[model samples]
Target chain A: MSRAYNFSAGPAALPESVLRQVQEEMLEWQGERASVMEVSHRGKAFVECAAAAERDLRELMAIPDDYHVLFLQGGATTLAALLPMNLAGADATADYVLTGHWGEKALDNARPLLRTNIAASGKAGGYVDIPPVGEWQLTPGAAFVHYTPNETIHGIEFRDIPDVGDVPLVADVSSNFMSAPIDVSRFGVLYGGAQKNLGPSGLAIAIVRKDLLGRHGRALPPIFELQNQAKNDSMFNTPPTFAWYVLGLVLKWAREQGGTAAIGERNRRKAELLYSAIDGSGGYYRNAVAPAARSWMNVPFFLPDAALDKPFLQEAEAAGLLGLKGHRAVGGMRASIYNAMPEAGVQALVDFMADFARRHG
Target chain B: MSRAYNFSAGPAALPESVLRQVQEEMLEWQGERASVMEVSHRGKAFVECAAAAERDLRELMAIPDDYHVLFLQGGATTLAALLPMNLAGADATADYVLTGHWGEKALDNARPLLRTNIAASGKAGGYVDIPPVGEWQLTPGAAFVHYTPNETIHGIEFRDIPDVGDVPLVADVSSNFMSAPIDVSRFGVLYGGAQKNLGPSGLAIAIVRKDLLGRHGRALPPIFELQNQAKNDSMFNTPPTFAWYVLGLVLKWAREQGGTAAIGERNRRKAELLYSAIDGSGGYYRNAVAPAARSWMNVPFFLPDAALDKPFLQEAEAAGLLGLKGHRAVGGMRASIYNAMPEAGVQALVDFMADFARRHG
Candidate 1:
C-alpha cells in the first residue's frame, strides 16, 4: 500500500522518511558493527549519539542552558505522577489548572504524591475554554503550577502559556511537544513522550530546570529521581537504548526539515486546513471546543448525526487517512495532525470530509 | 564487518535471522495496514500480536496456566522499585540474596519502599559464588525473597534457583530470561527487560503469579502497580508500542528456533566452549567466577597481566568480536553469551581467546 496518513493521537505516525532510515539501519547503523539497538548506551558510540541528540533537541527548542534535557521512559502517564514527586516535597501542595480530560487525569495521577489544589478548572466552564490567567486563584504556597499545553482527548489547547507568576510551571507537552518553538525560560519543566512530534513511544524527553530536580523530600524510585538520572546523564540504569537511538535519528530528521519552527508552521497549516473543512461544511460538521482554545494538534469534530461517524472514518481510511476515530470520551472524530503528518495529508482529509458532508448532510 | 559477533551485556545482540525478519517488517508488519508500532495496543491487531507473543513465550518455556504475563516499559530498573511496591506492601521485611552487582543494585533499589533484609550476600564471598541457601538468615514475616539470577557485571550466576521455602521468590532475569527453559511455577515473579534476550531495549516482560498482584497497601504510582497494568492488559497507558512490537517478533523467532529448550542447550554449549578455552589456556586467561557459578550469559575473564587488556579488546573488536570489554567495576574482558550469540559466535570467541593466549602466553 502507498503511504497513508496516520492521525493516531500518540504512539502515532512518524515521518515515513524516519521509518525508511530505521528500516535501512536495522542490521547496521552508519557503518557501526551492530545495529544501534545492540550497542550499550554507555559505549563511546552511544555516548556520542545521546549527546548529539540532546544537542539537536536543545538547538531545535532553543532550550536554555539552565534546563537539563533528560530522555526518560514511562511516557506522560508516569510523568504525570513523577512531576509531582520530583517537584513537590512531602506534605507539599501544588496548584493545577484543569482545562480538559488530560489535566484532570494528570491531577488524578498526581493526587497520591501531592496535595493538589485545583486553582483553575474548565470542567465547570464547559471544558472548551481556558481560564484567564488573571482569574486564577492559585494556592499561596503551591510548590508548582501544572497544566497540559494541549489536551489530545478534549481537543482544547491554551493558545498562550499560562502566567503562573513566580510559581514553577510544569507542562505535559506530550500531544504537541516540538511542534512549535516555545520560550523555554517560561517553564520550570516540559516533557513529552516522543511518539507524537519526536519519534516513538517509550522515549520521554524531559526539559527540566536543573535546579528544580532533586527537591522532593521523600526518596523517589530510582527511575523517578530526576537528579539521579541527570547526575548519571540519563544512564542511571540500562536505558531504552534502541528507543533513544531512534529518537536521535528523529532529531536528525527534524533538524534536516528546518527544525521545529518549519515543522510547526506545517502542522499549523494542516490543522487549519482540516478545521476550515469542518467550519465550511455548512453545519454538517461541528467542533465542540471554542475557537480560541481549539488545539492545532488534535482537532476533534462531530457530524450532525452520530450515525454517519463510522462511515466517515471508514471512507476516510479508504482514502488513505487513518486513525480519525475520536476518543471514547467524545465519540465522533478526531484528526490529530502531529508533526509527521504532511500538509497534503490534511488536504486529503479535508477533501474527504467535504465530500462526506455532501454525501451525508 | 562480516556479521560481527557482539558480546555487550544487555542491549546485546539479537539473532541475525530475527533482525532480518524485523527489517522485512519494519515498514509493514504482516498484512496490517500499518507498521506494528502504528497500531494501537488496544486494537485487535496488536491484541493478537501480544497474545501470540505470550503464547510463543509460554510454549517455549513451558510456562504454567496460573501466570499472567505482562509487557511493560522502563526496563528492569523500573521493576527494581516496582517489585517492592507491588509485593512488599502487605508484608514488611523482604529478604534479598545479593550475588553480585545487579543483585546489590536491585536490593538497594527496593530499600526505600520496604525493609530489605540481606538474607544471603555473596559480596563478602568475593562475588564469585552464590551463597548457600542454608546459610541465609531468613527474616521472620518477610514479604518475599528477591534475587538476580545472573549478575551481569561480576559474571556470577545462581547454580540453582533459590528455594525461598514458604515465602514467595522473585527473580530479575534480565540477562538470562528466555535464553533457557524455566519452571514458571517455581517463582512468584520472573521479570526482565527485553533487551538481553528478546528484542530491543525499552520493553520489559514479566511472568507474574496471578495471585501476587495489587497488594500495595499505600497508593502507588499507577504505572508501578502490576494489578493496574494487568487490569489494562498491559495497555493501561500507551506502552512502548514499537519496542513491544519488536519483542513480539523476537518471541516468534524464538519459538521458530525450536523453542527455549533448544536455545538453552545451545547457550550451555556455547558457554562451555568459551569457558573451556579460558580454562584450557592455563594461566593465560582466567574467569574470576567459581566454576559452578559462572553465568551462561556473561562470562568475565582476566588476561594474565592487566596491562594487556586494552590491546586485547582493541584486537578483538578489530577481529569482529565486539563489546568484549568488561564493565568498569571489573576491569578485564567480558564475553556476554546471550541467546542471540549463536554457537558459531561462541566458537569464534573461543578460537580468538585460544589464539591470543598462544601468542601471549
Candidate 2:
C-alpha cells in the first residue's frame, strides 16, 4: 500500500519530505560514510547538526534568550515526574488546572513529590470544557502552576495561557506543540514528547526559563536534573542522536513550510474543516468537546451508535485513511491532525465522515 | 565516499543490512502505509513488532524465563540511577566495582539515592586494567554488586564475570553487550544503551531478574519503577518505536549471522586481528590496557608521540576509516569493532594502520 493519511495520536504522521530525506541519508549522512544513527553524538558533524536544530527551533518559535531549549529522552511523562523534582522545594505546594486526561496525569505524577492543589478541574463535566479561570481556587505562594494546554485523550484544550499571578506556568504541550505560535515568555517550562507535532517518539523537548533551574534545593540523581541537562546542552549523556537528527530535519522542514505562523494558519484551517463536518452532521455525528475548548490537534467525535465504529474505521482505512480509532479511555473515533498532517488528509477524513454518515444514518 | 567502518564508542555503527531494511520501510512499513515510527505502539502491528524484538533478544541472550526484558527510554545512565531506587532498600548499602569511566559514572548517578561502598576500583591504576576479583573487598550483606563489564572510554574489559556469592551482580554492559555469549541467569540485571552493540540511541534495554524488582521499599514516581515498566511491557508511556523496531531487525540479523556463539568467535577473531596489528607495530603503536583486560570491542591504541595523532586521524579518514579519534579523556586512537562491524572492516583498518605506521615511522 502507498503511504496513507496516518492520524495516529502520537508516534503520529511525519512530513513525507522529511522521511524521504531521512531515507536518502540513511546510508551516509553528510559525507561521514555512516548513517546518522551510526555516528557519535559528540562528533563535530552531529554537534553542529544538533546546534543548527536548536537555532532553527528558536527562530521558528521566536524563543526568548532567557529560555533554555533542551532535547531530552524519556518522553513528557518523565518530565512530568521531573518537573516538581526540578522546579519546586520539598514542602512546596503546586497548583494544577485539570482540563482533561493529560492534566490529571500531570497532577498524579507530581503528587508523589509535592503538595498539589486542584486549582480548577473539568473532569466533573466529562472533560468537555475548560473550567473558567475566575472559578479556580489557586494556592497563594504556590511553587508553580501546571496544566496541559492540549489534552490528546479527551480532546479539550485551553486556548489561552491561564493567568497564574507571578507563579511560573508549566505546560505539557505534547499534542499541540508548534501547532500554533506560543509565547515562550509566558511559561517557566513548556515540555512535550516529540512524537506528536514535532518529530518522532524517543525524544522530548523542554523549553525552560533559565532562572527557574537549580532552585529546587533537593538532591536528585544527576540524570534526572533538568538543570544538569540544560548546562550540558542535553548532552550530559549520550542523547537520542538519531531522534535529534530527525527532529532537526523536521525543524528544517517546518522552516521550509514557512515557519510556525504559516503552519499555525494551515493547522487552524485543517481543524476547522474537520470540526465543521462534525458540527454540520446533525444527528449522525457528534463531538462532545465544547466549541471553545475543542483541541485543534485531537478532535474526538462519536458516531450515532457504538456498533458503527468498527465498520466506519474499516471503510475509512479502505479509503486510505488510517489511525482514526479513539483512545480506549474514551471509546469513540478520534482524528488527530497535527502539524505534519496535511490539510488534504483532514479534508479526506471530513469527506469520509460525511459519506459514512449519509449511508449509516 | 561509501560507508566507512564507524568505530564510534556508542551511537556507533549499525548493521548495513538493518539500515537498508529501515530505509526501505521508512515510508510504508509492513503494509501499514506509514513509517514504523508513525504507528501507534498499542496497535496490533507495532505491539507485535515490539514483542518480536523482545523475543529475539531473549533468544539471542538466552535470557532466563524468570527475567523480564524491558525496552526503555533514558540511556544506561538513567538505569544506573533507577537501579538502586528500584532494587535496594533506602538504608541498604550497594557494592560497586569500578573498572573505568562508565563504572565511576554509574556510581555517581547512584550515590545520591543509596549508601555506596566501593568493593573494588581500577581507577587508581588509570583504568588500564580490571582489578583482580580476588582482591575485591566483598560486602557481606550488600544489596547488590555493580560493575561495568566493559569500560568504553578506557578500553578496559573484565575477561570473566566476577564471583560474588549470593548477592546479585548488576552489570552495565553498555559498550560490550551482545558482543559475546554469557550466562544471563548469573545476573540480577544487565542494562545497556542500545547504540553500541544493539540498535540505536534513545532506547535502553534492561534484562532484570523478576524477583529483584519491587524489593525496594522506596516510594518512586510510577514512571521510574522497573516493575511498572515490566507490567506495562515498557509502555507505561510511549516507547521509542523506531529504535525498538531497528533493534529487532538487528537481533534478527544477529540470529542470521549464526547467533551469539558464532558472532562471539568472529568478535574474538576481529579483536585478535587489531590487537596483533598494534602489538606488531614495534613501539610505533601502544595500547595501555593489560592483554587480559583489553576490550575485544574497543581497542584503543596510542601513537609513539602526540604530535602524530592529528595526521594519523586525518590519514585514517582519508583512507575511509572513521570515528577513530580516541575519547578526549584518553588521547590517541580507538577502533570499536562491535557485532555490526564486519571483520573485513577490521582488516581494512589493520591494513591502513600498517601502511600509515610504515610511512610515519
Candidate 3:
C-alpha cells in the first residue's frame, strides 16, 4: 500500500510531489538546520515563506487588491461562526440560501450571532437540488447572502453564482475551492479549509473584501478581528507555520498544473467519467442528486442493494483505491476527485465500479 | 549548518527523533498508502492516533478523569478569548494576575466577553517579576482566576502556583507546558498551543474541568462550545490531524526520555547551564529577569552595550546557535531551551557566549 489513490473527501489527496518535497525538507528546511515546524514564525525565513504562500494564493486566484486574504485556523466552521461577527451590523439580518449540509451549518453557526433569514432551502427536496432563486424569501436590508457553493456531504454544487444584488455574497467553497477558476470579485468572501484542494487540515483561507470588515458594531477580541489579522498579515499571533508552508507548496503545484483553468477542465472530465459510469449502470448504480446540481469534486452514488456497500468499499481498498466510504448522513459511497487527484484515479474507480456491477448485478 | 540548536520561543524546537519519524512517514503512513495529512480525521487510524496522544499527555501530567482534554485550533490566543465565554456567567467577573505580556494579553482577550479584574500586575516592574499574591485584589465571587505560567517574550515564569481559595484557576501554560510535570488537579483549565514542547503549531490543547463548561450563560455557536468539542472528542469539526499525530509522536518520545519528571530535571539543568553562563559573564552579558521569576524555558539576556547585540546574534548564528535574537519588545538575545531543546544545545550556546565575551570584553 504505497500511496494509493486517496479520496477521503478532505484531508484528501495532495500532490505526491508536494509530499515528497515536505519529506525531503522535514529535518532541515531552507538550510535553517531545523524543520519548518521547528522555526519561529516571526523569523525572516518563515516570514518570507509565509509571504510567498500568500502571494502565490493571491496570484493563483486572481484575487482583487481590495480583498484581504487571511490564513486562519479552526477551518471553515470557525469562519462560519466568525462571518456574521465580522461582516454584519448587530441589528442586521443575514440571508441564507441553504442547498446542503454545509450551507445549513453556515446558517446555524451564524444564527447565534445575528438575525438570520432562510431565503431559500433545499432540505425539503432532500438536498438533491438548489432551491430556485425566484422562490427565495428576500430580507430587506440584509447584510449578506450566504450559501455553500459546493457541499461535500450532499454532493451538490452551484454551477453559477446567484445574483443577489446590492448585498454581499459569502460562499463556503471548501470542497470546490481550487478545482476551478472563480470570479473573486463577485463574492464578498470566499473561505474554506485547506485540507481539500489547498494543503492540510489546520489551515483555512479567507478571501475577504477589506471594506466589509470593522462594521460588526461590537467589540471583538483582537484575535477574532479580521481587520487586525489583515493588518498584521495573519501574524497577529503565531500562525500555523508548517501548514502555511505546505499550502505554499500546494499553490506552487497548482500553478505548475497550469492554474485553475486547466485544473478545472481536468476536474470536469473526472466528474463526467465517474457520473457517466454510475448513470450507465442500468439499475446497478444510482446517484440521487439532480444532474444539474452534481458536484465535480465529490460524487456520491449507491449500488442496487445497501448490502453491497461494505463489499464495494472492501474491494475498492483491495484494488488500492481508498476512502470511498460515503458520509454517514448519505450512507452509500463517495468518490472525491479533488485537484490533486489524477484522472487515472477516477478512471480506476470507474473501471472498478463497472467490474463490481457486472459481478454483482 | 546541518541542524542547529533552535532557541526560538515557539514554533520553537521539536525533538529531532520525532521530526525524523515524521519525515520517514510523510509519504505513506501506517500502510494507509497516504500521508497522515492526506487521510480523513474520522478514519480509525487517525482517531486512534489522536486518542493515543491524549492518553500519553494525561499519563505524563496525571490529568484527573473529571477533566476533559481537547485538541483544538487557533492556538493559546484564541483559547484566551474563549476562556471567559465558556467558563463565566454573563455577569461574572474574572480575576487575572498579569505576570508579563501574555498574561496581559489573556486579560485583554477575556475583557470583551465578560467583566475582568486585574487582581495584580507586574507591568509596573517592567514585567521582570510576578507581583506578590498578597497584593492581588481578588473579587469576592469571581468566576475564575487566570494567570500565565510562563511568558515567552518577557521570559518570566511563576516559580509556584498562587493560592486562590475556592476559585477555579485557569493557567495558560503555552511556553512551559511540558517542560515540567504539574499537579493537574490544581487548575480548572490548563490550555496552550502545541508549538513549544509538544510538537508543532496549528494545534492547541485545553484540559478543562467538566463542570466549568456550559456555565457561560450565553448562546455560543457549537464551534465555540468547549463542551461540544469535548463531547465530540475534539472532532466536532476536523481537528488538526497532522499536528495531532506529530504531537502524539513527541509524547511517545517524551515517555522514552522517562516522562515529565526526567524531562523537568533535564530542563532545569538546561536553564541553569545557560543562566549560570549569563550570571558568570562578569558584566558583559545581563539577564534582566529577577532570579526567582526567570523562565526555565526561555532565558532572555542582553549585552553590556546595545551595539554588541547585532554582532552577538551574527556570531551566534554563524556558530550554529540559531534563534538567539531576542523579541523586538526587548531587543537583546534569548536562548529558549524548551523540553525538546537538548542540554547539549544549551551547552553549545553557553560555550559560544563565553567565547564571545572573551573576544569582545
Candidate 4:
C-alpha cells in the first residue's frame, strides 16, 4: 500500500525501513518469543539494543567521552525544568536566549525553580528572527545559557551556536536533531524530544557533560536526577522501551543513509526547494521567518488569502501530502520535512504547493 | 513465528492478537498513510484512539464519571513523587502502608517532599504477608493513605482494600492492572504502569477523581502537574503515542475476552493451576508468600535447594517458559500470569513443573 507524505512536526514521519523492521519484529525479536516492548529492559537483547542506540548516536554526533548520553522520558518540554533542576543551583541565575516560543516557555518554566535572566529575546521581532548573539545581555556568573536552536512553531532556526565565552551552553534541539551534524563539545548539555528526526514521542535524549551531573541544588525525584539516570544508563526506571527500540532502528537507518553529514545536505536541499516554491509564488504563499532563520526541518508558510487555507490543506491531503497545517499559534501552513522525509516527499509537497498557488492565486 | 510463554514481571506479555494487529498496522493505520506513532497527538485519529482507550479502560474497570483518566509517562516510580506533588498540601501528613519494596521506595521519595507516616510495614514479616488493617497506624489528618495492592517482587497481594475513612486512597496497581474487576469509586486515584496488563512500558495511566485537580501545594513542572494533564486530556506534552495506541488495542482485546470479570476468573484459574503444581511437588518447591496473600499475578517460589535454581531456570527456558526466574530481591522463581497469558501457557508451565518434579523430586 502507498503511504502518504506525512509532514507532522512531531510524532512525525519515520524511515520506512525502520517501520518495516519493527513490523517484522513485532511478534518475535531476534528469535525471542516476544516483541522488544514485551521483553525486560534488563534482558540482554534490549540492553544491547539500548547500548547500540547510544553508541550510534554518539558516533553520529561525535559526542565527547566526558558526556553521558541518557535516553529518558517526559520529552524536551519536561527537560526544560529538568535541565535547571540538574544543572543550575537554586540561588544561581540561568540565562535564557529566547529565539521563539519554546525558549520563552522554557524560561517561564524555569522561573519559579531558579533565578533566570533573559539573555536575549526575539519575541519583540514577532519570533521571525534570532536575536543577534552580540546584543545578548548574558549574566556574568550564570549557571548555564539555555537556547532553542529551532522553534518548531514558527520555523525559526539558529544557523550557528552563539559564543558564550566560558559559560556552559545548553540547547533544545527537538525540531532539528539529526537533521545535521552538530558540535557536541560546544554545549554542556544537548537534549531533544525523540519524535522528529529520531523515532516516537514520549522518549527524550539528553547528552550531558559528565561533571555537570550530581550537582542539583535540591533533592529531586530519581527520574529527574540526571546523575542517577546516567549512572544507571537511563534505566533508572522502566523507559519507553518500544520508543527506545524504534529510535535504535531509526539510528540504524540514519547510519545506512550515510550518517548526519549526508542527511544534513539532503535536509538543506529539501528546505531550499520548498522555500524556493514559496518565494516564487509571488505573494501567493508567504513564510514569516527571516530568510537567514528559516528552519530546514519545519517550513511554516502562509497563503495571502486566509480563506484559501482550508482548500489548500484539503487539496494537499487529497494529493497524499498530510500534516502541512501550521501550528495554531502560527496559523498558516507548515511542512515539516524531517530526516524521514525523502526528497520525493518534499517534491510532492512542493508540487502540491505550486498546483494550489496556480489554482488559488 | 512461534511465541514463548513469557513470565516477565513487567514489560510483560501482551495478547498475541494485539501484537499481530500492531504488526499489520505498523506501516499504515486504518486509511492513514503513516503508522499511529508517526501521527500528530493532536490529530483526530490519535485523539480518538486515546479517548477510546480511556473509555474501554473505564468500562472494563467500571470507572465513575467523576474520575478523569490521564495517560502519562514516567511509570509508577514517577507517580511516587507526583502523588504528593499533586495531592498533599504543604506540611500535610500522608500515610503509607509499606507492604513491599515499592511502598518503602515511594515513602523514601516522598519524605523530603512532604510529611509521611508509615502506617504499617510488612518488612517485619519478610514481605511474605500483608499487614492487617487493624494494625495500621494512619495519621488522623493525613491527606491520603497510599498502598501497593500487589508487590511484584515478593508475590504478596492484599485481598481487600484497607479502610481509610475521609482520607483519599491511592494505589500503585502496576503489576495487576486490568487483571480483575475493581471498584473505581473506592479509589481517590488509581495509577499503573502500562506494561503488565495494559500494553508496553514507559506509559502510565492515572484515574484520578476530578476534584483532585489543581490542588498542588508546590510549584511543579507542567508535565508533573496532574491537573494540567487532565485538563488537556494528558496532551500537556507529546505522550507515548505508540504505547497509547497499543494500549487501545489491548483494551479492545480485553473487552472482547468478556471484560475484566471474565479475565479475572481466568487469571485466578491460571494462578491456581501453577500454585497447585508447586504445592503438590512433594516438598520440592516452596513459596514464601502466605497462602492467603499469594498474588494471582506474580507467584514467587523457591526450590528444595539453591543449587537447583540455575538448572530449573535453564530447563524452564529450554521448555519455552521464559522469564520464570524470580526477582533478584526474592531469588528463586516466579511465574507472572497477567491477563495476557492464556490458559494454555499456564498449563504448559504446570506440565513442565510436574515433569521436572518427577525427575528431580
lDDT of 1: 0.84
Q: lDDT tens digits, residues A131-165, model 4?
A: 88999999997899999999999899988988998
Number of the top DockQ candidate: 3
User: Sorted by DockQ, highest first, which candidate order results?
Assistant: 3, 2, 4, 1
Q: Candidate 2 recovers what fraction of true contacts?
A: 0.81
Encode model 2's per-residue lDDT on A1-361: one tens digit a residue: 6999999899999999999999999999998899999988888999999999999999999999999999999799999999899998779999999988888888888888999999999888888988889899999999999999999999988888988889999999999999899898999999999999888899999999999999999888899888888999899999999889989999999999999999999988998998889888885888998899989999999998899999999999999999999998898899999999999899999888889888988
Overlapping backbone residue pairs in candidate 4 total 0
Q: Every model's Cα RMSD, please?
A: 1.4, 0.9, 0.8, 1.1
lDDT of 2 at A68: 97
Which sections of candidate 4 miss by over 4 Å? Answer: none
* Model 1 residue B191 lDDT score: 90
**Candidate 3: where are CA atoms >4 Å away?**
none
Chain A (candidate 2) TM-score to true chain A? 0.99
Give the fraction of native contacts in model 4: 0.76
lDDT of each: 0.84, 0.92, 0.91, 0.89
What tens-digit string does per-residue lDDT give for candidate 1 at B1-361? 4568999987889878777877888777666556666656666777887778778877887888888888888888888887888885734889989888888888778888888888988887679888888999898768889889888899887767777787888899999898787787899999989988887888888889988877668787566678988888788888888777777778777777788888888988988898888888877888888899889999999998989998888888888999998888888989999987888888888888888887777
lDDT score, residue A246, model 1? Answer: 76
Q: Name the candidate that leads on lDDT.
A: 2
